[model samples]
Target: MDSLIKDAVKSGTPIDGADGLLNQLTKAVLERALDSELTHHLGYEAGDPAGRGSGNSRNGTTPKTVTTVNGPVRIDVPRDRNGSFEPAIVPKKTRRLNNINSVVLSLYSRGMTTRDIEAHLGEVYGAAVSRELISNITEVVVDEIKAWQSR
Candidate 1:
């Protein structure tokens, strides 16, 4: 166990909030999962020494914001040089998950402005959604609505 978590547990601190031990644990888990998922996608684990001559090796990571049911978090998402890997846990370009998107759209549909949605999401769900992100998500919604209307 991490010392912080251990101490928290020993001290009887609650671990249920966005800034609690559980949140930190979730971040670590997501990061490690992304790293390993990249490793699997590349057909070699990181630092294996065998990937030195491979065509596609570890190309470093990009900072990505992911919103889970627990809260909003920033995670380092690993990538490859080939640019073919599409993360299943959180796909490329789409910041929020379906559940989060539903919540965002629901609030937005209820006359909440983009800034209001951003601030409310950050405060309530720990998601630091950027204005650009909100626009992107809404664009997807717009496209879907267009298609639906046409149908």
Candidate 2:
């Protein structure tokens, strides 16, 4: 598993898209890293002539702050059964399981070039990832690194 992760990172695989290697990290690793779930009342509405009162939404969200050795990430979690739940880390609207941002960060840490990363993602993940996007994802660490350095 570790070697696979390293190879993916070195190759610059985009974490987006369904069943991609990077996406698998999210489902198999990140989500399970801090497995948590919550349920809340969505609120109630008056009844209609045809039926009883309705609810605004059956799901309630909880912002889960996941702490990792690298840093922390805030993941929004929605609670619902029947496969209606949507979590920000793995959104309901998305078919992918992994976080592209996380994949980029991992790759950047491993010293992969943006162009290399983009190409790797295209070949391995079947996604056309741009070098600019790879840079942007790594750029997010600038402030955090600076703060750590200053400290």
Candidate 3:
């Protein structure tokens, strides 16, 4: 497999069997994996910003390092959007501080009490996320909720 991938890369073949790529299966799998990873990490569909009116409004640049359940991801945040486009993984305004979004959401969905969720988070991530904080995070999704409902 390694040799196949190396050969394909050396030949500059498109991974997805675009032209005449070798190890098409491996390439396809990798492509899908990358897509899934980006979706899981970005929390928004690729190229789907919340608002497309004014573009990303930010100062020179907003640098943030987020530690998701998967691992740490560093991203440059935009200052502002036309109105407010908060990316689910590292909310636009929040600047990025480890993705507790998934953790909080998962715990809540699993029927764990708020206190239990807080303790679990503290034990795993060394930070205690209060129920209030969790609620605040979730509140940001109201727009998404509305969109879903409308749909």
Candidate of highest TM-score:
1
Candidate 2, residues 47-130: lDDT per residue as tens digits?
Answer: 324322332333444565544333344445555434444343344444444455566667778998998788777776666556
Q: Residue 45's C-alpha lDDT in candidate 3?
A: 45
Report the number of clashing residue pairs per model: 0, 2, 4
If both were scored by TM-score, which would come out higher, candidate 1 or candidate 3?
Answer: 1
lDDT of 1 at 76: 84
How does candidate 1 score on lDDT?
Answer: 0.67
Quote each prediction's TM-score.
Answer: 0.54, 0.36, 0.36
Candidate 1 lDDT by residue in tens digits, 33-93: 5565576677676789889878888788899877766777777888888898776446789
**Model 3: per-residue Cα lDDT over 1-151, one tens digit each:** 4555566567676644324432333223222332333333334444666424433433233555544333344444443333343343344445334546557666776887777877887898776455655554444443333332343
lDDT of each: 0.67, 0.47, 0.47
lDDT of 3 at 131: 61
The TM-score that candidate 1 achieves is 0.54
Q: Between the candidate structures 1 and 3, which one is better when assessed by lDDT?
A: 1
